[model samples]
Target: MLATRLIFVLSVVIGWTTACTPSDNSTSDIFIIGDDGPAPAETSGYFINHFGLLTTNLEVMKHFYGNVLGMRLMFEVHVTPEYSVTYMGHAQGGRNGTGFQTGTEMYREKNNLAGLLELVQFNVTDDSLVASTKRTNTFGHVGLIVPDIQETQDYLENHGIEILKRYGEPIQDFTGLIPNAFGLGEYAGAHIAAKKALMEAQGVIGIQLLLMVADPDGNLVEIQQQEQPAGAV
Candidate 1:
């Protein structure tokens, strides 16, 4: 009887311990829950998936991203009244990149391993709607992680692209890249900064060099080299 009672108590203790302990094999939330169902995840494997911008000159922008940067144009689409979309990415092995859909529009990819750049142009636009000022750093910017930073920088310079910010330099307007939804202002920012500092001290966090350049439409583009290159998709 005593042995049976001890076994029951041990079972109870084990059950309680298992219940209180955190899970090791738990999976992180990959999709957001909603009333209907989880919404499609916007980001690919990349932390930042893709960004789009309106351009006055499609051909010029295309040449800048395609010819100068050597990125492939995945596919072009014509949407409704006078709007066209072009997707570009670093093509590898002739495979299309990661494909994603927003609303009714479907965007394709050149490779699933990285994010993409979407270029939009309006064929018919009123003068009032078409702002004279181009998309510039004043608004915000997109960042890219490449294989080789110096080589990419040299290529841009040889193609007459001005590098606004050099590598290892603190990116001006860094907060602009972060969405306002992150709630990272003041107190939160200080807390995060402190945590990051602690992580860096412990060698838990890594750093990457960043370079800033302006695209054809004067849009600021930030590019960095990936610490490790991903295999072809």
Candidate 2:
């Protein structure tokens, strides 16, 4: 039954392409099989953690992300009346971590994970951005890692932000995409296109932060932010 359904959907998706006509109607196979299982991966992973900004008060942050996004909260921390942290999880905390924060009025301005953004809310210097601006990626933002990328993409579109597909020259691979000069950059690889495609397929939406450069600590920190609509904003 599932195979039949997949065939029907594929026909509609591929416009009933003639190439799909098989030499045999056997349900056992359609494409060549490789004995090798899934692709091998890097030992550690590409990122460490993802951080973001919330527009609402600290309590609101807890209510929406915890109650609404359905993300599990590993822990919560307090900085001040304006600042708080509610760490969210898609899985465990080793490789990738997602969380929420409300203190300095940071708004995420993008729709995909640029990487983990180290938010600096404490004003240890003379030029800290305490006041939130109308349109800025002040502290930083994080993207929701959705398995059904198309679902997320649709959700975002319905909300209002236009999704843009970027094409890379030569369709760059790992070497071209990673920051060659930095050891970590090379490890991270060129996944922006992959992530964008996944997000589009899952109908992805919500805030995405952009990372233009790495911080002095050799970490890629906060850049920009984007908020989801239909109330997640």
Candidate 3:
């Protein structure tokens, strides 16, 4: 009887120790409590094609991005007398050996181009229908990478583009360009101050050079110099 009791105690101790020990499985290996089952198969061959912007003046935007920035016009569609859409990108031609064209042909070959800028315009006569001036309250800015930042800066200056902030300039110098820099509620004021402090710190540490310019529509555009990797093509 003593031998049987000792064996039972040992088995109970072993079972308790095993139950108390932490799992060796990884966090991902552990199944979620409410998960239905395995995740569905992911869709393939997906890529970000382009970013669109609604502009009050399409021709001016076109001239700034296409002529000044040197983005090739991939396609242009005049949907109606007052409504139009234009797609522009850095690429020149399609995969089918055909040059970029306007209207239907360009629409058909649009899938071949990536990183495009789509500008939409609606020339409505009603004051209520027109969009207000470009506001930084929602969308921040559009970023464009250039081969040489200095040359690009000089080119923009020559074209009379408003330089909100030049390369290496202190954030304090361009505070006016930021909306509500002076006036903000309590939380927003603190947030902006913190962001400004961080930006200044980064600038002092010699981070990547950045140039900011305002387009004809007063939309901010960030310009950065492209840095190629060691073995990049």
Candidate topping TM-score: 3
Could you tell which candidate, 2 or 3, scores higher by TM-score? 3
All candidates in order of lDDT, best leading: 3, 1, 2
Q: The CA-based lDDT of model 2 is what?
A: 0.36
User: Residue-wise lDDT of candidate 1 within 1-233, one digit each (tens)?
Assistant: 97875665565545545665558844333122357564467743544545677786889999998788756766788887688998876644222343333312233333443456788888776542221123212345556767778888888889899877676554223233221111232324547544333323221111225667777776657677766434211
TM-score of each: 0.49, 0.28, 0.63
Clashing pairs in 3: none
What would the per-residue lDDT of candidate 3 be over residues 82-108, giving only the tens digit for each residue? 988888876433222236545455567
Q: How many Å off is the CA of 87 in candidate 2?
A: 2.3
In model 3, the worst 10-residue window by lDDT is 127-136
Q: What RMSD value applies to candidate 3?
A: 16.0
Please write out the lDDT profile of model 2 over residues 72-187, one tens digit for every residue.
45555567754555555432331223343422211331122333322333323344332221112232223344444445445545644333322111112223222222121234
lDDT against the true structure, per candidate, is: 0.56, 0.36, 0.61
* Candidate 2 segments exceeding 4 Å error: 1-47, 52-56, 78-83, 93-133, 138-141, 150-233
